[model samples]
Target: MDYLELAKTVGILTGISGGLALLMSIAQNTIGNYGEKEITINGEKKLIMDGGDTLLAGLIDNEVFLPSACGGKGTCGYCKCKVLSGGGQLLATETGLVTPEEAAEGIRLSCQLKVKEDIQIEIPQEYLDLKQWETVAYRIDDVTPTIKRVFLRLPEGEEINFKPGQYVQILAPEYQGNDEEVYRAYSIASSPSKKDEIELLIGYIPEGIATTYVHQHLKEGDTLNIIGPFGHFFYQDTDKPMIFVGSGTGIAPNLSILRYMQENDIQRPGIFLSAGRKIEDLPMKEEIDAIAADLPNIKMIWSVTGADPGTWDGPTEWVTDGLKKLVDDAKDSEAYLCGSPVTIEQIVDVLTEKGMTEDEIFYDKFQ
Candidate 1:
């Protein structure tokens, strides 16, 4: 063959070989049957999976799914398990969450820990109560221009029991543009004192699956499935003065906490500061005002980032800036905060700088 023909022939052969190599690699990784082995989980004897896969996948493959919010992404430190024995050395990806003591105790991020041999593991007790629920959307109301209040009542008799500040993961069902079920977390806006119904304050993000569905495509009586009540973000039983700060959907869990305090007649002295881009962004101002009015010890301050001249009268600055003027010192107060990671970091820095002890500051941040 001539030069051009010979080059074309070599390219075709290379492509075929590449395809075969890819197929063989996939087959070697997933197609063959992994041999049987006895694995002990939390002191319970069980026969399961054989070698060469991460322990998280092995457990899931054997019908035991861990509490992994990021699927197998390992970015979330949620998939932690205590490997009593047979687990190898600590993994690099898990070192951030697991301390040296914890590593010595055999605590490892299950997603990053591989199951080469039979192993034992322990999960948090609270996770045992976690479950996935399928429900129908009962209502949707615009809480603000950018925030939607979604109410989902369990099917005729199904019920959910969760704390007020807890959150749930909504499965973004496959739609025209996406084929995978994406899981997004949202706080429970309703009071925990009530059961059988759940409420969420969903903030819209353009092209975001769950947010888009809640804002546009979702209708009353649509089927939805979710799992959670995951994070521990609630009020502590203390009489310390409270300082609450939130913006955007971060307002979701804080609202629940305030409502819980109101419902229980908690008269602990406190101030709540909420931030928004404009007056229209203040979703539940009226309700919040009503609660404050009813509770003489509670106060509310609303900060608008981009206030209109001659239209808005609230503090015209960032939320943290306004909060700085409220208290000269936060040394004795307890703060409850929720928001994006950047927002949380800013607030935490300010609180610490203002003399608030590390123990007095608590936050629920979205990662």
Candidate 2:
């Protein structure tokens, strides 16, 4: 085997391998590609999109953002949509989120459903109008030891029109020790009257990506991205007396609603019940007190579950206990609740037991 002969053989083998690689790439592009497909939404709007991404991602790419607290990880059931056709079989994640009745009615989690072909799905009209906004962190106020109120200012000529109790998804950029960008939903803590500014009452979770960024890395003048006006936990436009229950930063949305009511002079009798582990856990106490003072029809109650009754000035029972004391008949009232899933579940059971119908009790479960 001479050197030239060996060189020629090696070159020939390299050329053959390169040719096969090119062919494989071409095959993948041709075979794996699902190409373009149509997504018919609510039988009114149709979108032409490439058919490969998950339904949630595809909707977002088409400017239709569905509420998913866990992004597209299929953990939060907030992105459930009715798929009349072409959603294929339900996966375990979808089944976990959807009840048997819901599954029978064609409900599926958008995050778990892939758009492999033309599909028809139904989403709320409000979700169709959801928008992603660019804002700057104009202010950060320490509300408590672990909670900070961040004020994001919209750019000129831009505004967010959101219901008082709705929330927005904050996009946390990559920072030290966190290598990827992520989105986390936080309820809008500011009143709807403040169209150009959005406030978020973010509680610091020691190692949480989004909370950590907001607490430690995020600063004034830093640009942030958010998409929202999500969730159906807002106040209904009815004359029924209202009950608002929350804990920790869960009070953010309730505070927004109270402030909005105060701004608009909606004086239906109401009670805002807030619970925390300790005095320090309850943020926005002064603001809540001021709102309650201004609105004669509204009352505020504070409860500390983990504190000793001898030390706490307010109710020492759970928030639900305060709720029971304030409301005599839940059949005539509407309730808006926000908190951890367990807390929301417990309160929902209590409300239902107290004669509040399922439709009258709206809640946002924090994941």
Query: Which RMSD values do the candidates have, in order?
Result: 4.3, 3.5
| lDDT of the candidates, in the order given | 0.79, 0.88
What's the distance in Å from true for residue 177, model 1? Answer: 1.4
**What lDDT tens digits, residue by residue, belong to model 1 across residues 1-367?**
9999999999999999999999999898776445555577768647478776778777655655566656556776777889888878897888888889988888899888767667877777676566777877888888788888888877677667777678888877877776766667788888887778888888888987777767777888898888776777777888998888877778788888888888998888888888887888987889878877877787888888887778888687776787778778888899999887788888888888988997888787875
TM-score of each: 0.83, 0.86
Give the candidate number with the greatest lDDT: 2
Error of 1 at 365 (Å): 0.5
Off by over 4 Å in 2: 1-32, 43-46, 308-311
Lowest summed lDDT window (length 10), candidate 2: 320-329
Tell me the tens digit of each residue's lDDT in model 2 across 1-367. Answer: 9999999999999999999999999998987479988999999899988887888888877888888788678888988999999989989877777999999999999988878999999988888888888899999999889999999998898989999899999989999899988788999989998999999999999888899999999998999999988877897999998988988899999889898888888899878888888887889898789888888987888888888557887787888777666677788789999998888888888888889999998888887
TM-score: which candidate is best? 2
